[model samples]
Target: MKGGTKKIELYDTTLRDGTQGEHINLSVQDKLLIAGRLDEFGMDCIEGGWPSSNPKDEEFFKRAMDLELRHARLAAFGSTARYSDRIETDPNLLGLVGCGAPVITIFGKTWQAHSKTGLGISDEENRALIKNSVAFLRNAGREVFFDAEHFFDGWKDNREFALDMLKAAEEGGASRLVLCDTNGGSLPHEITAIIEDVRQHTDIAIGIHCHNDGDLAVANSIAAVMAGAIHVQGTVNGIGERCGNANIISIIANLVLKLPETGASVRDLTQLTSLSNFVFEILNLPPDSKAPYVGRSAFAHKGGIHVSAVMKESSLYEHIDPALVGNRQRVLVSELAGQSNIRYKAQELGISIPEGGEQIRKIVNHVKDLEHRGYQFDGAEASFELILQKELGTFTPYFEVIESKVYVESGIGGRNVDQAVLKVRVGEEIEHIAAEGDGPVNALDKALRKALIRFYPEIKGIKLVDYKVRVLEEKRGTSARVRVLIETGNGRTTWGTVGVSTNIIEASLRALEDSMNYHLFTLKATEPKPAAEENH
Candidate 1:
């Protein structure tokens, strides 16, 4: 490999440190599934959870033994033995040994503050734990990675003692030394200087782990790599305790897309978006649409100037081709959108508009008018598409609502219940249904789904994922108009729809109707052609 093609090792601790996130709780099966997914993306190492901390992690290691991981080496994570016990007697070391993972990663205190105050141990004992733990693991025929916790902070406090800790790990037969920014407070310049100092003392392979406390985890990790670190430790989407860990997807994007000369390709960059969404799905969390490289909005152009410039020369507004990372550019329509924005969005929706035609201009004016009336299409592309289709003479009515009513009652039981009755027409058939729910919106959703599910069975798969209401005008106080945004998903795909009206219930209904319509239209378009059309 050339000097430019410096192969940087990619390590994922999503199952371990990532689980430290408050909302993240993955089952053993979830860990196993994510491990395979990471391997599929060619991750160099996947750190399974710590076996000594909990039974789930221990069980995950037990189950992971049978997994046929082709690309990633599974690593078991744990901490060094405490000061009171020897490595052989430590339960933490025993758990790591029992896991039988080929690689073992253990973290130990390097910061004098942690040793003197936090761990209440002498500085000599802390260094002893680092040396003995690595030696114990290495003698057990396991590849040991000694994580120097708080290395950057410790170096700032006492540079000599910090370097001494690194020397102790190297003497213990450790294969790699991982410097951790545990508190996530160090800046890029501090990290680079400290890494340079470490390189001067030892020639061991260096790795970096960072937290996003200062919103600089990505920046700090990149700085460490430039300063000679070979391995980068991070979670899939930066999910971790407090703020989060460094996002490896962004790091890989930088290394592969921006630093082309580095020749550091973690996996097929085209699979990044799919891999990001898959992990979020397993975690049962919504993907951050604005996340760099793989988010929905990463390539979406919303401003009129941006839309026009991108349509002419994408490089004017976009830094890279979104397709390179399994994403695509989106031209959004809004009040600020010009004719070019309207035409570009229409084309993206598979609708053709004649050059210099009135249809595009019409859409531009209609969008502006709607925006003035409190409709936002930037976050609700599905609703924007429906509006475009209706104006372009391509939309067909899926169903028509005749009348709807919602009633709320608080009886002697002291619990409020909402009931909704809906009447709708699908061609010649009229369906009237009533349902009870915890709230008016819930009741309305249940009633509408009940009325349409039999006629459009595909509606059954559509689940409402999120609902948010925003006041468009505060001056009106209780009578103010509100905009409601609803996010719906059909197992694999998610879409946003928006509606605005003075009445909250009406606004919610409008958004709900648009959501179902969008889903139905998509199903109808993708449905196989009839026998006659196929024969023709």
Candidate 2:
């Protein structure tokens, strides 16, 4: 509870409006997975989909009906009944009622422009359309939530008509009236004033649904809540049409922590990061590293001064405890690292920095040199930990490199084919493998993995999760110093490694070697000590 101390309701429309994001098409299975996660995270209302629009959505709703959700109530979304049709007879309206969801959301034209142009109907007819649809749903014993689409712009253009539409929904027994900034261009102060105006007119509860065109969706939502709205509607990760919808993950975190003075109680804030990651994984989309509160880089700090201060007192650099969101703070090792940073990083790896040691400086200088050559240790924790291990003299190579070469052939039709040959010595055994692929980098990865699998069957479980290549010198293009970061997952854990070189194939090979080496290093570190060492 916050402000007036009402229980704030969270409505997630990730399956419906969130699918409108470019390149995001969730099948019924994907929708179910997302819904299960949302329920797990304790969302209040999960907007399943518009069952009338497509077969996929219809199937999602039908299937979701069988799930026994503990906390979330499934809702079906669709537009209001047509102007001329009766609520009982209209197919669209009947479809909404037939969906079998406890709650049904219907959007009506709050703007006169939409009424005249989009619906091609007079203002009175549009009001009647809103009233009848809401009343019809109410009569069916379904909780009716009315979304006043384009309410902000509609109110700016014609205040009386917009208020009239809201009044219509209220009189029709709608449970909540949501004002939508559908275009998402409203300012914070403007949203506050409009919400206050609506509050003064209606005795029903008010809700806010904002988009992020101005990058102010979160701000506008907070403003609406401050001005008296109890319900907030948004999509996870801000996935929606055009710019996107409000980011509920960020909004909830901010409200729970930043606005604690207002007396809000979020029972489990740590679930925020996990929820964001779960949605991103299901969507098959990369999570934004810089997303506020829940992103990977949210609590990451670099530079000698910042790291030193953080080691002494994390509050010196961190705004809130990262553990509050189920994320840990990261101290980045780069050219900005000093002796203190090196020692801290070594200590984190369970390595003790000896007294009067020059190793810290050596490690710092080496890291700076590597960073100057375009090796980024910030995003690749596994690679950085390996570097730390090497500096501490605790790292043992899993395999010795024999030789590797890339070959290319040109066909009669000017087609280019590439292949890579890799040879490595594991103990006294030598394994050789050659693989052909579309590019030199791909072929090298395949050949390296193939060769390593012979010595270590664990390598077979390692699969590449993500690959990113960045050019150090943009002007050089193909000849630039390329840095490749590869993320490998072994069904249980994921680790990232980085490599840099002027040759793209060389960079890829280096990264591939580091990935396999990291896996081996972890296995060795976790294994039981020898009998002699344990007895000592």
Candidate 3:
């Protein structure tokens, strides 16, 4: 490859470092799933996990070795051998090599404080441990990556000693020398200078490992790359010790979308958002909407002026086209709505605002009033679309609002008398479904789905994926209002809808109704036409 044409390698350690985050644990199967997805996303290396630390990681590395990875090399990670131990007899080194990974990463102390205090060893002994561990892995026919733990703080305290450690790893045949910001306190300028100084001393490939304690992991990692680092090491979703590691999702999205002139083509930048969501979903964690590039609100505009400008030309407010990172621009409807905002929102819902001069003003005023009373249409797009449908008289009921009744009977004696029954009518059909669950909400969801399945068999496949309930404080004493957000999903797609009322059950029901209606509405809109149109 030409000098400027070389692609920076993305080395993802999510499975290893990410699992270290509190309350986040991945099973062996989960690790494999993540590894597969990362490989599919074109990551250069998937640091499967530290085999020496856990059986699950050992199993993952062993199983990963048998699988055919197209774009990712499976790497096993571990720390260097104990200070007094020989490399030949070190169990950590033996386990890492035995795990069957073609690549192994070993971390060692570079900070003088850690060498003397944490490891209780002299500086010379720490350097020897780093060199011997790297040499052992390299001699085992495995590519070795040496992580100079706390290299940033180490360089700040003892620059000469830190550079000496890098030299030791290089002489031991380590493939790459990774400078880690273990404390995550280094700024971009500091990183740039350190990388530049290291480049002047060594010809070895340089890499960066960063943490997000200061929320600058991504910035510092990018700075290191700009300063001549070839590999960027981070975890997905920025999950790691302390705040987290550099977010590979954000880094990749920024590099691919904002720096296209750098001679690197990330042709699949469109997959970035979905991939980020996928990893978060697998971890069963809520995604941060404000995360750069791939977040939900990254392209959302709610301010009147901003929305108007964005509606006119998205580039006016958007830093980069959201579509480049698998996202789309979202014009949010809020209290700050102008006439342009109202018109654009209406247009998005396929609702044509009559050319009358007063129509836009009326809609904008109504939107503002509703928002002032605690209606957040921006986060509830499905409900907003429903509003547009009603305004345009474009919404027809998918099924008649059949009377729904629920009954419950509890056992008084030894006889089994406890029972809950639900009945509903849709169009000409009357359906009765009953179920017992831990709560009324659970029972209601089951009964509703059962009844809807009679008229729409597709309802059987739809599931409530997420449900959130918030108590509105206006009616604090006797009739406190509640807002419910219900996220429903078929196997292929998901939609979110919100409902508000004094009664929590009533709010949940309304949201559930909207969820089903939105699914049916979108389904019909996207359905294929007749054979004649298809042929044409």
- C-alpha lDDT of all candidate models, in order: 0.90, 0.88, 0.82
- Each candidate's clash count: 0, 0, 0
Answer with 1 or 2, whichever has the higher TM-score.
Answer: 2
**How large is the C-alpha RMSD of every model relative to the true structure?**
3.4, 2.9, 4.2
Highest TM-score against the true fold, candidate: 2
Native RMSD of candidate 2 (Å)? 2.9
C-alpha TM-score for every candidate? 0.89, 0.91, 0.85
Residue 341 in candidate 2 has what lDDT? 77
Displacement of the residue 208 alpha carbon in candidate 1, Å: 1.1
Model 1's C-alpha root-mean-square deviation from the true structure amounts to 3.4
- Encode model 2's per-residue lDDT on 66-103: one tens digit a residue: 88898899999999998546777878878888889999
* Model 1 per-residue lDDT at 340: 82
Evaluated at residue 384, the lDDT of candidate 3 is 77
Q: Could you give candidate 1's per-residue lDDT for residues 27-86 as a string of tens digits? A: 999999999999989899999988999899999999998889988999999988885356
**Residue pairs with clashing backbones, model 2:** none
- What TM-score does prediction 2 earn? 0.91
